[model samples]
Target: MRTTKHRLAVVTTALLAAVGVVAGPSSGATRPGDPAPPRPVTQNAVSDSFSDTYADPSVIRGKDGWWYTYATSDPLVSGGTPGLMHMARTKDWSSFEYLGTVFSDATRPTWATRTSGLWAPDVRKIGDRYVMYFTVTDSTQHPQGDDSAIGAATAPTPAGPWTATDGPVVPPRAAPGGGWWWTFDPSGFTDVDGQRYLYYGSYFGGIWVTKVADDGLTAVGEPVRVAVDNRYEGAYVVRRDGWYVLMASAANCCAGPSTGYSVFAGRSRSPMGPFVDAEGTSLDTSAVGGTIALTQNGNRFVGVGHHAVVTDSTGADFVVYHGIDRHDPWLAEPFGINRRPMLADRLDWVDGFPRARAGAGPSDTPQPGPTLGSSLGITPEDPAAGGFTGMRVGPRDRLGGATGLVRGTASTRRAAPAGDVHVRLDVRGDKPLRVTLGRAPGVTVTVDPRGRTLGMSTSGAGRPLRDSTALPRTSGWQTLTVRATDGQVRASLSEDDLHDPYAEVTLERDRLRVGSAPVRLSSGGTVVDNVVVTPAAQDARELAPVPQAGALITGEEFDDASTPALTWVRENPQARVEDGQLRWPVEGTDLTGGGNQAGLLLHDAPDDGDWIAQTKVHLDLGSDEIRNYQQAGLVAHATDDDFARLGTVAIWNTRQTEFGREVAAAPDGRTSYGGALVGTAAPTMWLRLAHHRTAEGEHLYRAGTSRDGRTWTWGATWALGAGTEPRIGLYSHGGASPAAVASFDHLRFYRTRWPSDPGAG
Candidate 1:
């Protein structure tokens, strides 16, 4: 499994001042890097003033009958500076008003230095006062290295004049190798028996839970690891229906447009968990099994994770989380910081697991806000325990066996419920099973075991409306689900784990009206049992327009006349531009891991607004060989120790697009390198870096790659220092082997644009 990457904010400031460059518009069009106008809060987003930069959010109901939320330290708007910790509140959970930071410079912890960052606040009302547990990026006790620890602060009210503890609540743990295990993302939970626990840690150290003293200021016992490392982070625990559910975020957060950060879940009987997902797969195993609680649904929001589950006064649960806007990805004007806004959606318990809006994922349209006040202890019924009739049952076998075996050729069973229904059943058959919604002529979804196909047929359709051939054919009973809502129907077949379906299909819309018919299932010699029919929530919302690369600011065609002297800075002067391409032989040298021996051809990057740097490279690092690491593509060079590189590279048997960041590690200024994988690589691929800067001067470069230039997949971001003015460059290095040459067709730069409504264009 590919391990998730953890983000470490670079402490160094930009060494050089930005030099502004202007490019004339082509044909009197808008200037390439002009900042787009502000957009009004319409359908999807929930936050108001703190819309763009509210990250790692936690929501709670306060005594004032209003909902309060806290987030990691970040500037709320462009050109603003980060505060110690951000806070906000709402009367209705949909719209919010910024309540300012938790601490001013005078009130912040004295042990925290100028460079220390207060992150991932976990605020809870413990005892008589509210205590906030936050990750202190650096402390005066360990001033030299990145020794992050948990710190606590007390306040009489949710928004208050807070008081800090003298020392760390949970000190950082030294790693077995060196440095320290990342002690971050703190969350508080109290067991039903009144035992308090604090859960913290990140990718470096798996999430762990430790008993908290009655005062809630110190740990009472040794921490036990709950979720394994490299897979989960940002742990939040909730007790529901005699089970303790652990929800954690996975994948790279803050990769700009490429961020795949998502939320997943596991449940155990105890808060200190040997937690397992719906498949009974352990969360601590190498397989890293997790049931999807929330993920990007190809809407405006992405990088949706690091959440808090809140229950409203009406007893409805809602998941409050942060999501980055794909179209306006950056928080800073033009480009620089990721614009992560807080979002909330109703949560429903299905099959004993919590799903965001019944597996619809993040909403891009307006949703009803949560009610004020504490929940009144309402527990939803488990959807799996539904009523079914007209089924002949034999001796019951509930453990990995058939509950009801069909004896006849085709047996039809009627199920309860009508509108927006979700029907699931465990079935094993040699022939086929058909699940239909509505009346006799309702939409029918067929699962063909022999042909390994999943197809759907509507009322008046001459043929199947949709057919998917990727169904897994196995001997064991497979779980099949059919969801029909909002004039659309979807069907999926999985190995009992509904979260990760093996094959799924979205059927074409027909004249059949949903919610007007009852559920029916028919199968031939198939074992069908554990049938669940429940109402699936309608969450279809208007999505924002997809982002488009704007007009070109500048480019290098690599023609013969394009020399290295005028605009380019040649590092080794070995390569030349000819035949409309820049050709350079692969070198044995590299610029990775504190080494900077490779040659580079650099060009000045624009200092204004958000922009994209792109290059088309054809470098074939043959597969199945021990290529080690051979790469050629784009680089945003600050210095050898402070750069973000995006390239099509070969590592062992796999070829991938690797976005690597080399930065000065904390404590001492030693260089450390880490990477996040983006899209897969083809021999001829186009690489891009969408560059932006935070209000505090941190440079954010989101990586994008394309096998075909027109279609792109963007992923995770790497950061340079706040003040660093990185030059865009190209290089070929890693290994000399087999004497392959890298050919660069052109290097182009384009202005970034926040997408307008789809109908506007």
Candidate 2:
């Protein structure tokens, strides 16, 4: 059976403070940054099996060794197709065997969208039964005037004899136009202790993470608002190296060829808090998240969204999603509008996030196979378009998936006969076969199985040429390779010029010819099961990777604000540089969406690579009254949800004392603050945040402080973030008093150094 990527991922913390959930351990798992050789993937975009298109594929492998993909797509067009939910399965992803619907659409719940059916569905096994969470919506009006529900159902196996529940698990809240999308799109996630949590929501209310019953039929507690951003949906959660990663798709989901769907990501040590983006900005019920995974390739592909991930035996994550077919992007009359095909590509980790197909993906090249199986569903057409004119041939199905058939016509002619040209087929009929190049300006060639010489003639606009010379006929099959290169009927028999003294002719141009009269199969005659046409040249070449990246040691001494023009980006234009220093005048600001942080001066590091960002903190309140939690210091923020902090002086909200060397971590999903506390009273302090790789190939982050900018004492180290690529810089916050101004001096960053690294020169 296929394994569920979300369920199979075990993100267990050592101890849960609220529920006391314990995390177990494992081995052989390499760090994401480890430079080990890949497990060997053959190619990308492997799902090209069905005659009809498949979209929004919910991929999970059953324990039965078959990769079952239940999609929000149409039913299979075969005689052996299965019920309501369309399903296609294969041992590998290549040769899919379609099984009919799992349940009837007539069973739509009372709260469900009538006629619209299911939008997003996720199924996972609990105990001996499979529980599926689905979004009941009218897709025709999705993200616009649509109302939907997140519901549940259960089945005995993945193949399903499913029983629908009576009502919606997460009912639809009132949706206002241009407001938070508070409905549908549910995902079932299982933690290390087998605890099940349901994550759901749309662009309206953002994505919410809630603890669900082990049966996955009910919620256990209040849902927590975790992530938000640009038309977000399809909430998928996974755990890697002690971090709960949230992945979602950006909107314009089904806009035919004009769709702009892509994956955005955010992470936290816990499954819940201030989930942020790459630039240290926290996402809330209204903001866009950070980074991109897969996106539009080029003109050849579009609408790359509504995705799901599956891991192989080698622990590699391959994303199975849908995109509009660029060749026939829009469907013709009677076939709707879009042709969304299921595609697969391996996920690559750069810095600290996932990049699809090494980031050069969504390609149109003839990629290799997944190497997990022997069959390739994408086949060339039979009796190619160039083989002859006026003939209709089906696609190649060498695996016996189709019936071989061919048809054409012919016209009576004295000169080069037209209508049906030659059919370079392996099929040799019971009788002699004749082929006419064309009439008037056409040529002709004929062959008899019993005859020795092949007859050839031409009666066209050019000189009439005719020949009936006895030519040897090969046994078994005649492999004919003909090319209209210059003017001669250059058959693949000899290299010499096709010139005869008795028959001399030349063809200057070509017009539609070949079949001149209708022809029928003598007795259900056979032909090649496959045919293909070599298209004109395309720029579908594979791109190479850049070997090494340039090292970054960027710094700003803050000597002249007008000269270097501070490299930091201001989210608030009011924060400006003054008197040779970066000044953030906080009139009332918060660092995250959950309201735990307050302050507004922030900056980004040179790169996402490993680095140590440090700066001198200066506060010139001029004896004015200060607010509690009013702090200024050096910050190393990987994400707004997860980051390290060090303040020269932070007034205690409870003790009412200014403490120096303040440190903490803003959990992505949880409400609790994390980090070791060190006490001190100082107006000005030097701060630094360092990150480096561990012996086992993981990342470690630490915060340190210095009194005279020389004597330093490093704080406790934290190693909980799953993403390694980081944004290290400085930050300041104003709590209680909104009109607080924080300043920084001589901010600089260097390549990260570990406890084991040699000192720099």
Candidate 3:
């Protein structure tokens, strides 16, 4: 089988070279890049930050709960003076507050005089003070390894005022047992016993560890060689589960796309002894190194290396590093390689191995923001279980796979991690408004422009309860407020009247609602600016409640930068995250060869029982109206020869057609397309495939399509004759426009009952 390509994707100029297209399940034809069963991507994918860039980053979570990132001086690129470490802070990795440089160039020590410049640096918290470890060379040589030294500086807080040692803290080792010796990049380690140590070195010399004094200004013990991973630098040590994971950067870091830089790792029982990869090859014995922690994933992040790890209040870890930009990758004059911006991704320990999302590396997809948005503002009676609390959908996107709304309310109901949910929603539209709530185990009160309406509902613990009411129809910007407390709900269309005596009503439980926009009308879906669920005893914003293990499922909205629990695999580098959607363009040569299928597959074990995979897909024809049998939607594949497909399309004879493929019995199957074609005004199709066991004991698959994410119109069902479980994939193909511009607005997988809601504009 052809191996999966998770790194750089070679753009083949041979378009026609990849021939043949599978017209339907009734045919045995296959697409290009479909030779192998793509591996699942459990990879914590990430993308460039919002208009921020930095190099050689050292990230850490301070004792104060905020995350800080310190970087080496980029005078070579930013035309700034040396000795200035750039800094930034973030509550959630999604948004950051840039704090400029840490110290002035005047803080440069006289002993360290490397003309080429200061290299990798690290920061640590020692005895309530911030201690930063850095490396510098005194010579202007080609390789700045020899004559290099690791130094230290201290400050009261992470934002230092001014403090630099007179010389290199850890100078050259005279009689060190070694293979190769070059000193740079000092990774600091605060041992379990509160003692500070450092791992420093580079190139052929090998990495060594040394204990430092309590002051962090001098080395107290002799250096010893630990790992000699080939050409590795930027040594970092992570102690977890009684194992020391040594992660370092490998390969040439700055030759543009030709740069071979990637992150490799090894583990050991003790801090200074031997560490090795899965094969038991000691990092000190072999130059090739141990297991890999991060690598290139072609979608745009290239030459991913030089990284550091930090943890959230919940102890969830994320790695920050700099990587080459696939789009504008070029050596920008004297700055070495430009566009290598700071990128990050969450890390997970699978079967004892610390891996990037699904064992993959840096991805270009927009990931979910770290859920650490706010600290608990209050204390709670029940312990917080970070479950699938709620979701925020933006304009121009589908509801993903939301199922829980029945009747008018929603099926899903969850309590505040601390208190009641106080919803303050900002909305704008001219059409009449309809809101659907799937959870209302109690009474619900609604207010519209006409009058006040009330409904009583009952939902068992974790069951579905639906409720609906007309929202006050208003044009222009306005605020809709809802506050639930003790089965009583106080809601209003105006923020000023939320708590007014007349605006108060009663609701059984807290429920989330959906709008009625078709396609992003101006700004579609619903934008949530302030969704703070309050706590009665204390604020839930300050509480750093850890997430339950089961909440880390394979459901991806392409909105957060995190590793999903399920493995997601990409077949080629043609996929990307843009405008908050997972998009795969059909450039004539897709994963389905000359046909209309290019997709990324999720390797979810079918043995996990029955499931429903759903997503929102749309084809962009620009101003040109679609004319061909444009197809795009969900694909379920068991092997190279079997699978099922469902989505929205314009066929040779229909409009927004319900198009699908059923390849159950090998080379011969059947074709199913939706009969009702949606209007072209707004063309986002919500599609789902539910796998169930029939009375005959056969695992039957049912396909459905929706104009909106809620209600579903069930379509054809096919019996399985191939593999027991199939992989879920998202594909885009065959639009009259050769661009094959199809986009998946959102994707989610559910193993339970489906909920329906009203369609949004």
Candidate 4:
């Protein structure tokens, strides 16, 4: 729903691939240009929805022991009208009672257009009063269209009878080219040294952290850019273990099912300057770096981002954010708007990194709720500090003296009762290390640094071993956690404290024996330190398997000549279908921005139900060179100005699968366009657009792309208005520079299985 900065920069493939799961390690391990290790998947984060359509939520616990939440101006229920702002509070976090809007008609700010939106509310306790900072979508001071700015308000209680300042707290920044930079998503932070700061801005101008004056209303000194533009937004900062971590949401925040909106993190020792990812890559680079914080697993929920972190009574953190259920994506009746329900999940600190649901992404299952002074029927174990007897102490010279054993050192610790146990330790060196969790016949997990691999083997015969070459490079210290639960041993290795495990492996029971077993560590040539063994809590539940695709409705072979006239309508006679292929030459025309001269070969979409439209296209616009925007693929067109296009396009140095949309701008009759990235692109890529119609007629089109045409990666969905009927089409446009042609293999349609309520836990 928040569609500002429609022309934001594109995220490069190098940045996106940083979190992607590849087959194995890079061909050249020691090469400086080697790709980062594939991140391991963590699942089973139980989440419950509190309020529907509560986008960009900010939450804080009041002195009264109730957690109060504030959300961007949106309807709280289906077919409901939006308020000035939405607020709710819950003592237990399970049930919520709406406390009504933060601003009444008489108290709402009026320095902008009468229809200006108030969004992304951030509340903090300042001095003796609670202060809230929010985004003003337009400002009379900036007159030139959507010049959003940060506005501050004050109240005595969480459910505030608030009062806004005389003017914008952080005024709109004028862009050099005209209009204003996106000064949105206002968040407040107070450094350890008692210096207050205000974090604001979006993908348009990058996320910036600025010093706050004593009043907490106006900014002082210079603003520091913590994250680069076009990649991160909704900046939230937390200070932990002498590090200032910047967490932000990436991708389109409102793209229905295609909403790949997820949270990422970077940390720096100082409150500002040089925040980097686990690989020490700066967040302000073209090849941007960010540890994956919260991403969508293949589940009912997508677009899980724009979050707020609140610590419960027991000192555990919970991430309160918004997500759209793929099945029921929109608000009830007039359903073009995305229905982003407020959700909360446990936030765990594995090492020093923040992982939502221990890196499980979003959950659709019933999970152990947050600990608020009372036990959640689960008891957390305190890890043993130090308990190991040295066997063969390693070389004292090459291996620096760390707490744990180093190369050539061997040690064993007495294990606790069977049930479930977890061993956490840090490893270093360029050699391999062996860890035996239980006993001699227990699970043996090996960490190989030079090879960038993780191997697991059980002592029992006929029990197959498992290995993963996707382990992060171990030039520095890495955290390794091995867990044994119910006869299953799982091992995960993290690159650094700021990341989730980059590699993971699980081994089933073989000659495995649990009970009063012993834990052994053999640092073959590697170094191990900070050993901690504890009882693991089996609180996480396994998620149900992802639902499979339903029946195929139609599979167009693109071979018949008369089908182009009977089944498809060519907007222009610039393309031809011959020999089971639709050949459309690359055109110099375009459909993005203010241009709309692209040719379209259209086919009427399903008139009644939800369906999927898929096409395989071969368009090679050579990479590492500027091809401008030459692209060709599938399109769901409503008009020249209203459409959703999915194409493999050459954007600057990289080729990307872009799912972009254009729609008529409200109030102003011009068209506004913005693009969200999908998966990595290949010369021949399979693209699919899954379309669903709401009861009120809005169309939701989700984008999916595959490099091999089998394993598909679905991304953010763009919503089209119900004013016109959109026809599925194929198009070729953008400057046809370094000339290329696009050949479409076929067009297929499939029926979908609609879930009654996918978000219901």
lDDT of all predictions: 0.67, 0.49, 0.49, 0.66
Whichever of 3 and 4 has more TM-score, that candidate is 4
The best candidate by TM-score is 4
* Candidate 2 segments exceeding 4 Å error: 1-45, 73-84, 106-113, 138-146, 175-182, 285-287, 334-336, 366-761
lDDT of 3 at 470: 38
The local lDDT score (0 to 100) that residue 68 gets in candidate 1 is 81
Error of model 1, residue 541, in angstroms: 20
- The lDDT ranking, best first, is 1, 4, 3, 2
Q: Assess candidate 3 and give its lDDT.
A: 0.49
TM-score of 2: 0.44
Candidate 4 lDDT over residue span 1-761, tens digit each:
11112221233222212211001111111212111112122122212344567889888755433568888888777778888888887655566778899887788887756788999999876645678899999888855679898999998776888998888888889877777889999888765334678889887878898998865888899898887766779988876545788898877887555566878788898778688865566777544566667766545677789998875333346788888776676677556678888777778766566777666556676555543231111111111223455533333322224234454545444444343555666565776888775445455788877776788874443324465545532344566777665435677764322222346677553222233355667765565554545445332232222223568887677777656432433355767778889888888888765767777877778767878888999998875576878899999988777888999887655466777767665333555465666656678989888876666667777677877877765555566766678988788878866778899998888887433323323
Worst ten in a row by lDDT for model 1: 12-21
lDDT tens readout by residue for model 2, 501-608 = 111222322321121221122123334322211111111122223112124487776666452423343455555667778776543544544554443334555544
Write candidate 1's Cα lDDT for 455-517 as tens digits: 876544233345555553355556676765444567766542213244667754422224333
Best by lDDT: 1
Candidate 3 local lDDT, 132-229, one digit each (tens): 88876653222333466777787766666547777677775433664224678898775544355788987646788888775667888777888652
Task: Give the runs in model 1 whose Cα sits over 4 Å from its true position.
Answer: 1-43, 333-335, 373-761
